[model samples]
Target: MTVTRFAPSPTGYLHVGNLRSALFNWLIARKAGGTFILRLDDTDPERSKEEYVDGIREDLEWLGLTWDREERQSARLDRYADAADQLREMGRFYEAWETPTELDLKRKKLLNMGRPPVYDRAALALSDDEKAALRRNRGTGVWRFKLDQERIEWTDGILGDVSIDAASVSDPVLIRQDGQVLYTLASVVDDTDMGVTDVVRGADHVTNTATQVQMIRALGGHVPDFAHHSLLTGPTGEALSKRLGTLALRDLRARGIEPMAILSLMARIGSADPVELRGSHDELIEGFDISRFGSAPTKFDVEDLVPITASVVHGLDALDVDEALSRAGVPDRLRKPYWSVVRGNTATRAEAGAWWPVFSGHATPEIAEEDREFVVKAFEMLGDPPYADDAWSDWTNAVKAETGRKGRGLFMPLRLAVTGQARGPEMADVMPLLQKKPSFD
Candidate 1:
């Protein structure tokens, strides 16, 4: 059986960049009839919050991306400690003491000498007495996983045949001096112990994956299949890292972006497949193929969601929008046809609240100065109350016949006088639903 995990730190609300990794893992697991785990990387208890964890769950639920089980790094401290001890016993873990400024100077010196700016294992050169003295002065030092100094390679599920020289890369810091386990260590331990078979994440983590692959092998764990999807950028291809804070899933939902609209576009934005609005989770699952995706940075436009959301709106049945229509003050009797009439004109059901006034509220016509005379004449011809499907045509025809006005001159003013707008659903369907009869003075 296949297994996958979407491990996120509960330090902030989920943004679109985060969802790309999450949805990929979820869809892969679902398509394989596998188990998908939602792991919380809350090792940094100081920054993690219960509210953020709740928000993550709420966001996933809203997207219909359900997880089978959840695991928290905080709860698995003993397991990580055991793994750390085992690595130490295997001589693959060592203590390192270096301040931030010391590391920066070392990096600059290495670059000046035209060498890879990797850790020089200075800690490994320290004598036993010197190490004891330094530990006493600086307290505990951070733990670094010693690398094999060879080429680490893997056939990536998406990028294909990735290779990294371990000699050129710094030994990863696994545990801080404060005893907090970082993502690299905790993820390797959890993924190994939890039986996660596949790992999918952003391209930025490809180097991390290369390092974690070595860590997994050292601990006698199966190295899962890895795929690094490209990162998202702005519509104009600007780096989205700075703008992701504003694209939180909650914000999009508040703006009335349909879940399907988001899911549909996200699933295909950088893939070879063209994005098509899927009506349900199953349809999304059926068409999800990670192999069809490329490694290029995907350009995402929030504006793209509007028409897709409108497409979703146009497909909804009456029951799907009944409560919305009712809330819009459409009498229960008329909601059926009311939605049918206005559905195409809306991008989301939330817009129905604004449209309700056109039928139920006073007709405040913004008649252009030039058309005021024709509009007043047209309103005079409109009969009082209880309109029908033929009311607009009948009224416009009568006005056209009496005033010698035709085409735009005759039709434009009547529509503005009656509905207060020039563009919307068919006037024929909008006429009978109007309860506030048009008034002329």
Candidate 2:
């Protein structure tokens, strides 16, 4: 069966780039009827933390992407060690006894000669006895992969055929002198051992693939297909990073962004395809295709996400909005009023007033007259009676019976009187709250 994996290094909060990578992987796995794995690459002991790993899992789940299997790279040290041993036995790797200072001098000397300062493979030509002596004498050194100086080429699903000569690439350290496996070695071993069939990750990992492909070939492991989707860039064209103040998923949710909004934003960013702004999770899954991903970097714009969210929010039934607000920790006192404004503004549903304006009007008393009137109308329609459980139907019926005037004109005056505003939350949301004793009616 086809299999794909999202391996995130648990060193920080789940950033937008990481989320995008996971989304693409999920899209491919779901589209192809393959297994999706979430692997925690927490190998950097000094930087990785349990909290970060937990946060990533929570973030992915929040985005509606679930993995079929999970694994941790740190827990599979023995597997990486075995791979390194096999490569060493097959003469595909050699222990470099050069100290940092020695390597620096070699690089500097090569640079002084106006040549690219790559690791000199001639340094690995020690005799068998000499290699054994150095191994016994040197207490600690890194193991470097011995790359065959030949051109390597592979077809990427997104980038088409990519080729790079081995001479231009460095013989990267597979295992540090401290015995901890490096990221490349551990990632390749884990992906192969877990039977991953497709690798979908950010474009930042595009250059790293060459070294990994060499490792896989040397170890006699199957090389999975790769698709390095473009990275999410900031407006200035720089890659998205924490230093750039990119928004986190939790932060967006806290700010009242609906999950579907976030998903829609994910679909649109760096995507060339025209996807409907509103759809169920299953609908999105069905429409997702790898070819839809754009090659150009996507700018992470919060403004672009607002309309998408509003579509999702407006399309939901009343109960769905209630549930979403409840999960967001919206207060009971503000729930009815907030939903009132949201439902009323659904027709306009402009990006500028979707969440904050609606939330502020409910939580604060600073709403405009027009907006407040809508709020009152909504509350009234939701069976929130005027003056202590007095329903609008009864009030309209009584007023019409006594004055011979219809219900339409009475709605505007009643709405204006209660909320002191003209165009805010609907009467449906306002009436229920106004039904409380000492009501404004």
Candidate 3:
């Protein structure tokens, strides 16, 4: 059976960039009736907080990206240790004792000689005595995986055939001096041990994927199919990394962006398909095609979510917005009619709150100077609250006949005077929801 995993470090909130990877993995797994694992890369205990882990779960729940199971690297420390030991016994793992300054100097010297800044494996030349002396002097050095100096190639699920020269790439550090298991080793161990069959992430990990392919083979594990989706950018193609802090999923939810709106756009953004508002997870799953996605940086505009959210809101039934309507203080009796009245005009369910005040007559009226006399006369004919079904038509007809006003000139002012807006639900539908009659006095 097919299996996939989304491993995120529980160090911060999930932004749109993170959402893309999660959504892709989820959709892929769901489409194939496969298992999707939510793995927490919390090896850095100092930075990873339980609150962030909770936030990750909450965000995924909000997006309907339910995982079949969850795994944390913190809980699997012994497994990583075993894997590291196995690589060391195979002569593929070695201790590196270079400080950051020393490594930087070596890289500079290599570049000055027009050579790739790959690690020169200076640690491999050290005798056991020298190694013991260095360990005593500098404490414990980082563990680096030895790459078989050859062309590492794979048929990427999205980027087509990919090839990287292992000779040009430095050996990856699997364990830090602080004894923390880095992502490369932990992910490789987890992916293999947990039976993950596919991996999808951002394009930035392409090189990592290449190195990981070698590491997987060296460890005697099946290398999962890997796809690197393009990174997201601003609307005009500016780098999205700097702006991710503001694009947290919770912030978007607070702004009343619908989950389906976010899901629909993300599933198809860089793909060949045009983004269409999906009403449920089934729709998104049925239409997802990872092969259809392009590798170019996807241009994401937060503004794009507005119209899609409005579309989602417009299709909602009364029960669909029951919570939002109730929070807006729309009584049970008014829920259906109130939604019917404002659903067409709203871009979000929260907008129902704005309309409730208008319907209840607590909103300030917006009458224009030229139409003040006309609006005052119109309201005089409106009488008191608990109006009849035809009350708006009757009152408007009386005002139209008395003033010879018609069309937009007649209806626009009346709407503005009553609801404090030039555009909203039709006056006919809005009339019955009024708790207090309009007063332009």
The candidate scoring highest on lDDT is 3
Scored against the true structure, residue 117 in model 2 reaches a CA lDDT of 87
Q: Looking at model 2, which ten-residue stretch has the lowest summed lDDT?
A: 348-357
- The better-scoring model by lDDT among 2 and 3 is 3
Per-model lDDT: 0.90, 0.72, 0.92
- Residues 1-441, candidate 1: write the lDDT tens digits: 899999999999999999989999999999999999999999998999999999999999999999999999899999999999999999999999998889999999999999989999999999999889989999899999999999999999899999999998999999999999999999999989988899999999998999999999999999999999999999999999999888999999999899999999999999999999998999999999988989999999888988999899889887788777777777888777778888888878787655777888565776888888877777767776679789988987888888999988777777887778898888988888888677745
* Best-performing candidate as measured by TM-score: 1
**TM-score comparison, 1 vs 3, better candidate:** 1
State the number of backbone clashes in model 3. 0
Q: What TM-score against the true fold does each predicted structure earn? A: 0.98, 0.76, 0.96
Instruction: Give the candidates in order of lDDT, highest first.
Output: 3, 1, 2
Give the distance in Å from residue 287's predicted Cα in candidate 2 to where it truly belongs.
Answer: 1.5
| RMSD over all Cα atoms, model 3 | 1.5
Candidate 2: segments with Cα more than 4 A from true spot = 99-114, 126-138, 242-245, 323-341, 344-441
Query: Candidate 1, 271: how far from true, in Å?
Result: 0.8
Candidate 1 achieves a global lDDT of: 0.90
